[model samples]
Target: MTGNRTHLLLYAVEDLRKPLIQQLLAYPQINYSFADTPSELLFQIAQQPPLLIFCRTTERSRVPTSTPLIILCPTHEYHPAQFIHEPAIVDIVAETDLMRLPFIVLRELREEHAIVRETHRLRTLVEHTPYGVIEVEIDSRQIRWSNKAMHHLFGYSAGEMQNLHIEDLHPNDIHTTIINAFQQMSSGDETPLIHITCLHQDRSTFFAILHRAELTGTGKRSSSSFLPMLLVNTKVSAPCKSMPTGSNSPCARLIKDCTISISAVVGQL
Candidate 1:
């Protein structure tokens, strides 16, 4: 569980002179980082961002998405969400409600804790499952984690998958499409259906369907993970040969029979 009174990043020019800055710093619930200019604030934002921020409406353009901004402007004329490109914002204290900032901070802390707890629970559920699971980072298409079954399906040992990127495991054209789908899944887009071919230790390939969704982690940081249920139906319907070919090697004949069985099953899908 995370601390309810976690620090929030804020950017202000000559922050020491701002009256609200002193109060915000003193308040245990809100901890802010003060920057002198938009450029400085952006630099700090790339390094560390707060869950919620306090800044003037004119400074809205400077806020980062990681730190959802709360405008400290006098007028409630603009919805802070619109003026700023941040995903969400809670306009608790405008200039008119200066006195109420402390109370709102306390309330926001409690509500924020609840949201964090729920997200943790969901991630726990996904992580604890017996099914082979993987969280693929969208931008880089890297394998974040792999479950027990996934470890078995691929020859890679426990920590070995971490060394391999998704594109390296999956072949060419499918790599780009899968990476894009994973990103969309994280952004609340429709769940991506992936039919990925995983290579086994002996260099044999097997297919599995990937169920993907965006996991909203702590502080709204997002990553894409999936539950892959291995489909093992190779034995039941192998290709039947009325007449056996004498010329082919035993290994060649066996592989040919397995391929035919896989084709029939895929046709049913």
Candidate 2:
């Protein structure tokens, strides 16, 4: 991991004013970069953020950033709750703690690196998977994630389904069935792949092979939502042939007028 040298950013008006800057540079494993002004510091952080930032608190306003920050101030002025409570603000330190700073920086850096590695690995796995994986909130029916295949089969572009409720994708006749399946799964039932009529963005419909799996380890993020589940859908196929398209059936007329205007009032999409 040390093959790529760790970058440490120090932002202060004067380099000689902070002895810790020179002290940190003495460590061969870390490379140092300096930003003389707040704007310069923000630019560097945005372009290529360092492993840790030791910023001398400035009078100029700063925006919330994802980079881990160590706000340097006098011990009397330091307030952990008020200053370091934000997600990006990792810790507040006084000048007196200069000798112990390197160890704290190293520990936080290692932890952050590990998290990035794991997230990247999971993202790679999700993107390349053969099946279209989807995560949804049971109560709100909000979609959390959808892979490329899901978008293609549903006739939606990337992120189009994010704010859409899962119920909107299904015909009205199957809403009860879908909800029942989730309810059964919540009651500890082993879910099997079921066929359902799913609507495409073009208002066309196809039968989808759907498999629901409860997300047990989702933790508190979805706990209040009652249940969180993963819906894996395979390739879209022809609609069910169970419905007869004979001349006497209403569906036959609906199919004839399919290109004109298809309505869900008669039957499932």
In terms of TM-score, which candidate is strongest?
A: 1
Write one digit per residue (lDDT tens) for candidate 2, span 18-113: 677656755656566777777887788778768777676662236337567777777787766777346677777776667666767777867767
Clashing pairs in 1: 9-50
Pairs that collide in candidate 2 are none
Tell me the tens digit of each residue's lDDT in model 1 across 155-227: 7875888776665555565777656655666566643243355556566666544544233433343432432
State the number of backbone clashes in model 1: 1
Worst 10 residues of 2 by lDDT: 259-268
For candidate 2, what is the lDDT? Answer: 0.60
Taking all chains together, each candidate's TM-score versus the true structure is 0.59, 0.51
Best by lDDT: 2
Q: Which residue window of length 10 is worst by lDDT in model 1?
A: 228-237
lDDT of 2 at 130: 46
